[model samples]
Target: MGITKTLNDDLIANRSEVSIAEFEASRRLGAREGVGGAASWAVWGNENDDLTIFEDSAAISPRLRKDVVLIGANFGLGGDTGEFPPFKNFHARKSGGDSKLRKAITGTALEGAFLTDIVKDYPTKDAKGLPTEIKSGTLDTNRYVLSGFKTEQEALGLSRDTLYIPMGDTTRILWDLLVDRGVIPAEQRVFHRAYGNGPLFKERPVTYLRHYAGAVDMVQAVQGLLAQLNLR
Candidate 1:
């Protein structure tokens, strides 16, 4: 139940508490809530795209209880204020990005599955800007980001059988990069072999779909994809 088990050692070592006024100041600038799931663990960012994890309370170690994982592009906004303020869980909104994602997973195997984003803290209105922002960071920092990602995955208890659902092309691209960098762990490289799962993801255990942040019928689209992969 200690943060030492859920976060990277370096992050835990650097974490601290902020004043009430400082926390409110960040929220006014559009800082939102934490990641969704049993434990409210969130990886948030700032205007600069520096990422960090925030958790309200410690839960069991490696809380990934399912074989399916939902991967997103990045946390929308909010900088690292070192404050664990309460906010809506990931994809909990009824419209726009959150609604689209919420509808897609409803009544499917993906519902309540473990969800996360590739880029942690950098917030951008359009994910298209992600590439430039990601490239803006130093090589060592980016590599550290991947190392942190690997740390989170291991902390969450993800293994080879885990099927990652990339929310869109952007997410897929980032996830692929992580894999190439060996951030996804070599043993967990099994791809979905179902016939209709598409040759695009033929080499990875990823089911592709358009980003819910756009104007797409994510529910039907994702359901169809999941059905094709025998996850319905």
Candidate 2:
């Protein structure tokens, strides 16, 4: 099928490619090699706090697909070297952050994995003043950045012809944008509504997770959703 007939113009004016290396790397990671479900799978988040979701998703299924893209919010201008989120700033205490979690997640397919951020070429900057995000046929990360869900869908090379699964609030932001454009149903836009379908997710609400083990439950939720979504 072509673009979705179910919706109108949802993409931005452009869809340019930013960092070729980053794009290729992320595409490789998002591949579903020897798998049975999606051709690829990627995850985007609000900030570093959401890495736990990625970690947990991988923990539950160690042999999980690598076609995973962790999209996080990247603020500020671009330089030659690609940019990553200032993850430390997001931590609550900042001084004595989650050490064990860091050890478990980093270099293990979770922490600091790079993808195109919503801030466009900020993740793969070579010069100072260049277009990043989305435009024409160019594509950057925009799940919640400039063009929001439209750019995100474009980055995925998808339209309403395909389906979307928003795992957490970060992705929910994009879903809400689709709703704004009359793409998604309004009822699914509930902010505080339940998210994942895992046992731990059902045991504790997303809100309650913050009060306790934090990223622990968040990881469970993403794993549940990914397991469910991959089947499609």
Candidate 3:
């Protein structure tokens, strides 16, 4: 039989090994100073546009509103009639592929930081106009992931006036529980802007939450994570 990419023995053998290798290399670090800095937490997300965003009048502050509008304008925000925009940098630290492994390790560090400590959830309303806790308040950053975005830089449009949190395993667990309880359907649990490996939406939890947070932030984190892989 002719060989195909998936049918190759070497490719399959190497895939599992790569994951384990990543895990082992991460372990050698013992602990990482993840998430507190822009570089650390940024990897929790990947690129996309089409996240839910509020107009300047709806979100929190004027300065943020100004930033949002300006950023959006740069992207031709609402015009919906322009060529795709250029890649803008967030001034973050990391870049490159292998971001998944780096983000996972960084997450380990964040969980350790949050253990036994409960952070306050700033209140925000859901689509139902009912009060919803922003949740994961313990991450100590006002940022949360923005769903329904269409591009990585598009995340910036959501951040100008509202806080976003990068969703983590913890928050994802919370979302699952919400689904199980029928609080919302499993489909509602994710933002449906980009296609995953297939037609399904991919759930990437990294997000920009603080003023320093954005698409640029995620790119930086990815860079930092890839850099760490050099040790392995």
Candidate 4:
């Protein structure tokens, strides 16, 4: 009924290894030079103050590790607080709408030539009108999409030209298998942070695992979709 229930059920029933393999492969590709552009941005400090693009090798060298990775959750990183602090409150009512803030963030990332991806989970229906099935691992029946510009100058097209990947249940299972195999760390799990104070903002690390998997799936999906749409 709810997203968590759906994902959990999928994880329990999923039985595939291919998805995880694909996810790892994509991660390798994303990390490769000349495949995807790289840029630096600040990980917001407390209250979003002291913004600084992470440029120092010392600050970013850890990301070069084989196990180090980045997973972009659907919502912004900071979980909601009842009151918006000054720097982090750029999305507050006084500021522009969330959409504006999102665009600004994306724009900044794009300017730095960073690749961005989006992943979403939605229900699947069979001809009989019943929920068809749940997927596991990195790939899920849920849709995983990827989009980004070929170059920083092309960034403007990102808003319109997203590629899609149609992943099935087996894909998700493979992701879980990879996790079990120690290919990806559990801490890299991705989850959406709430925008405002909500019960869901308590910050459970496990819940974000699905989101991390979703990010991997998105990268692969985008590559496939681009080939299919002849946009590559």
Q: Give per-residue CA lDDT, model 4, range 1-232, as digits (tens).
A: 6332222232223312223332234333333322231221213322323323232434432222111112231212233321222123222233233223233333221111222222211212121111122223433322222221122113222222221111233333433443454442333332121111212212422222222222234332222221221101
Better of 1 and 4 by TM-score: 1
Model 3 over residues 34-70: C-alpha lDDT tens digits? 2111111112224322112111222212111111110
TM-scores, all models, native as reference: 0.57, 0.31, 0.21, 0.21
Instruction: Give a tens-digit lDDT track for model 2, residues 1-232.
Output: 6533110021111222224333333333222221111122222234324544334433323322222333322322334212222222123233222332333334333333222332332333121222222223243323223443334344444344332333234434543543564544455322233333323346553321121123444444443332221111
Top TM-score prediction, candidate number: 1
Once superposed on the true structure, which residue ranges of model 3 sit more than 4 Å away at CA?
Answer: 1-166, 189-194, 198-217, 220-232
lDDT tens readout by residue for model 1, 33-114: 2221112222322311121222322322122124555667765544442332333336232336665665556545454455
Model 2 clash number: 18
Of 2 and 4, the candidate ranking higher by TM-score: 2
Model 1 C-alpha RMSD vs. true structure (Å) is 12.4
Give candidates' CA RMSD values in order.
12.4, 14.2, 19.3, 18.5
- Misplaced by over 4 Å in model 4 are 1-49, 63-144, 147-232
| Candidates in descending lDDT order | 1, 2, 4, 3
Clashing pairs in 1: 44-121, 45-121, 49-122
Off by over 4 Å in 1: 1-65, 81-89, 92-95, 132-144, 186-207, 230-232
